[model samples]
Target: MKPLKIAMMSMTHGHTRKYYQTLKDNPKLDWVAVSTANDEVKEIFLNSVDGIPCYNSELEMLDAHPEIEAVVLASENSEHLRQMKLCAERGIHILSMKIPTFDMDEYEEMIDIVDKNDLVCQVELEMHYNPVIVRMKELLANNEIGKIKSFNATNITLSPVWAFPWQGVPEKSYGKRVHVKEGDPRFRGGALCDHPHIFDMIRHMTGSDFDCIYAEVAPNIRPDIIEEDMLSVIGRMKDGTIFSLDPSWSKMEERLKVPGPGWEVFPKRMEVNITLNGEKGTVMADCFGPNVYHNGCPNDRYTVQYTYFDEWIGLIDEFVDNIRNKKQPLINLKWHKRTIEAMNAVYESIATGKVVKL
Candidate 1:
């Protein structure tokens, strides 16, 4: 099997660090060059001692490493279209970060570009690779819970503003500076924008699309932040299943320049748990839990040491297969478009204080 030559661009996303080790160690990928043009990101890559070359300009990197077949666009949401266009123009496959673009037209443009080039464009919604989620889907499919009547899910986490300030910037994170509410200082980008896993995951589990959605925002946990840190969404699926989701950055964190020890003020910095009530029984799951706990560290605070950080491994494995085998990824652009639409509906609901019909 030929290993896919992969590069990363724009190391400004929260998931940027999560892919470093996987990219380096994965057998199916040759983690080549990284281009950011950000001094801080370059310095961080230099300090990692991974020996992977870094370039200040993406064009320079591509010029030097013409063999690169794919790239992970680990940049802010606003840059997705531009970066994707560069990759598409080069006939390079792309592993896009979640929330490709809040603008539907731009999202459709991405689909067209990738389709025209016949390139494999996979969105990085890695939760589908989670072991727990895999089992959850199995149970749901097998009718272990009969029929899913309703579900409540949480894709909550601590804010990543200190580490990646782009998340707090409305224009960068949400691709616009539109206010979330008329009288509110908060903008469209925030916790809701940061967490799209639940919204995407529910669709896969139920094999249904959103029908209608109603969303509301609460006072942000951290008033200092410019975006909304807290919000909730209630909606109905096309299959008549009711759903409620909390995709908020409700957890608090210490302002850390780089995400590492002493960052999380809460015992659990991130969580993606779900409870589904079906006709026969109820199912509850923690997609990233049952981990080892420790307190003797840089912070001397209790923390969850995850047993598995292999979501990226599986994701990349599929990505490499898609490239090598000429197969479309399960979360291709067309399939993920509806997921993006559902998320946008949540924002529209908040702005209008009315239920949005998808």
Candidate 2:
């Protein structure tokens, strides 16, 4: 297979840094230039990576590297539509961040752009590519756990606001500053916006669409931020599988400008754990665990040094395959539409304090 020449844009998302090593090392890719959100982001990118030229704007990077075939849209949620439009206009394939936009209209516009351009746009739900998840899917396919009756998952992480300030802004993270509920100071974008994996994952596991959802938000751990920091969701799938999900920033972290050692105040900085009760048996899986631990660092605090399974490898590989083979990704815009709708319904449930039927 011919290697795809790729670049990255708006190096501002929390997951942007995670892609550096994968882009560099992937033999299927020819890692090209990048466009940063600002000079500070450029400096940070320069400090961490070398050789790849960084541009001040997306147009400048694209203009300079006209051979680029694809890009990783590692940008704020608000910037997704604009960036997608730019890339689609250029006939460039895109690997978009998790939450493309909370607004359904803009989401439809994004779909239109990709469909019209004949582009391969993959949503980055990296959990789908994790080895544990792959195994879990296999076991379910083999009926090792029989018919799934209940599904529970947690996609918890320390708040990334300190490292990526836009995450704390409701307008940027959620694409608007709508209140999460009437008379609530908190806005609609927070932990829920950051963690869409479980929302998407449950659908894949149950082979069912969402039937109804109920959600509630707890008091923010960091009340200074207008967006929510902690929340829980419970719902039933169309196939009658009951599910409870916690996609909260319940894990605490140090207020670091850059993510690095000692950033985690909690021993484990992030977790994606799943538990399923089936007709025959039960299965529990930790998607990100059994990691190495340490008490030596800048702060000497015990922390989890995540030895991740590098989900990006498979993710990027699939993106490349989709673009090269004229095939749709597993998490394409159309297939992921219901997942996004389900997430939007979660916020609606939080707002009304009632179960939302989807």
Candidate 3:
């Protein structure tokens, strides 16, 4: 298959840095151009060694690189719809960030635009490509643990607000400035918006849609931020599997503009640990752990240096395969709509202080 000409827009997302190397190295993608949100982002991107052309406007980038067949919409949660519409207008395929938009109407509009343009729109739920999660899915499918009775998952991480401040803003992160509750000091966007993998992954594990969900928010760990940083969700799947999720920014990190060693004040900067109890037995897994430990010059603090990083490789591969072979991706917009609905239900449950039925 020919390498699909690709570009990236809005270098303001937390996942922007993670995709540079993979985009450049992937055989199926021809990393061509990038457009930044502003001069600050442009300067930062230009300083990088990738040497890709940077444009100040999406139109300019798209016009200059007319050969570009696809784009990675690496923008904030609010910017997804506009950027996606631009790509759709140009008849280009898209690989959007995880939280496309909190507004269901906009999400459906995006689906309509993509369908009208006949383009491949793949959401970046990269956990689907994680090897450990892959193994977990296999085990569950094999019924090695029998019918799943209950499971708990933690998608905890240190807040990236220092590097990506948009994450701290309610409108940009959650797509609106709705209050969490009447007297609550914080707004709707925070750790919950940043972490959606566990919510999306549970569906693949149980082969079920959300039945009902109950959620609660704890006080913020970083009190300076105006969004909720700690929260939990307990829900049941339609298939009778009950699950709990801790998708909080509980881990602490130094306010580093760029992530590197010494950024973590905690032993592990990020963790995704899952535990399951089934009728026959129980299983435990770490999606991004059990790696080599190091305490070196950067911070002199012990840290877990990650060993696996090919999730994006597989994700991009699937995107290209879907485009080239004319097959729908596993996590297409229609399939992901339910995950977004479930997440919205979490916020609704928090606001109403009652279980939300799906």
Candidate 4:
């Protein structure tokens, strides 16, 4: 297949930096121009990348590079719908960040817009493409652990709010500024908004939708930010599999303006580990692990230097195939709606202080 001409918009997402290498290295994609949220972000992007045109606005970038066929919407959660609408209007294929929108009606509008444009809008759920996750799925399919009785997973990471300020804003991260619950000072957006992979992963593992979810919010680790940084969720799946998930920003950081070597105060920084309790046996897997360790350079603290895998390569490959072959992606807007719904239910459960039935 011919390389798809692709550009990235709003270089503000935490995952935006992760895509730089993939966009440049992937033979299936022609890395084109980029549009940043502002001059500051543009400078940040330009400092690292070379020989690529950077613009202040999407329209300016699009006008200059009309040949651009697809875009990676690496913006805040609130910016997704507007950006999606703009892309849809131009009939451009989209690779949206994980949380498209928190509002269900807006999400439905996104689905309609994409459908109407006959465009491939693939959500970036990179965990689906992780090698460890692929192998885990294979084990589950082969019944290596027999029938799953309980699914427990942790998607914990250091907060990116220091580097990406939008994540710390309630309206920007959660698509609204509503309080998390009655009398709670913190708002709806935080770690839960950042981590949706475990919620989506359980569905693929168990072939079940969320039955009910109970969630509780802990005091903010970064009390300066109005968004909740720590939370826990326990839920059940439609297939009778119970689950406990921790998608918290429990790991501490150095409050760096730009993410780099010394960003982590915690050694591992990020972890997505899964444990399955089955009738026959139990299985434990670490999604991003088996790494090299070092306590040198910027910080003398011991840190897990990750031997990063190219999950984005597989993800972009599927996006390209979906566009070229006119086929739907595995993690398309329609297929991912339930996952989004489940995430919203987590917020509802937190607000009501009761189990939310799905």
TM-score result, candidate 1: 0.98
10 residues in a row with least lDDT, candidate 3: 42-51
- The RMSD of every model to the true structure, in order and in angstroms, is 1.0, 0.9, 1.0, 0.9
Error of 1 at 333 (Å): 1.0
| TM-score preference between candidates 2 and 3, better one | 2
Candidate 2 regions with alpha-carbon error over 4 angstroms = none
lDDT of each: 0.91, 0.93, 0.91, 0.93
Instruction: List, residue by residue over 248-317, the lDDT tens digit for candidate 4.
Output: 9999999999999988898989999999999989999999989999999898999998997689989988
Candidate 3 residue-wise lDDT, 222-299, digit = tens? 999999999999989999999999999999999998777788998788899999899999999999877899889687
Best by lDDT: 4
Model 3: per-residue Cα lDDT at residue 281: 96
Candidate 2 on 1-358: residue-level lDDT in tens?
8899999999999999889989999999999899999988889999999999999999999999999999999999999999999998899999999998889999899999999999999999999889999999999999998999999999999999999999998899988888999999889889999999998999999999999999999999988889999999998999999999999999999999999888889988999999999999999999987899889968888888888869998999899999999999999988888988999999999999999999
Error of 4 at 240 (Å): 0.3
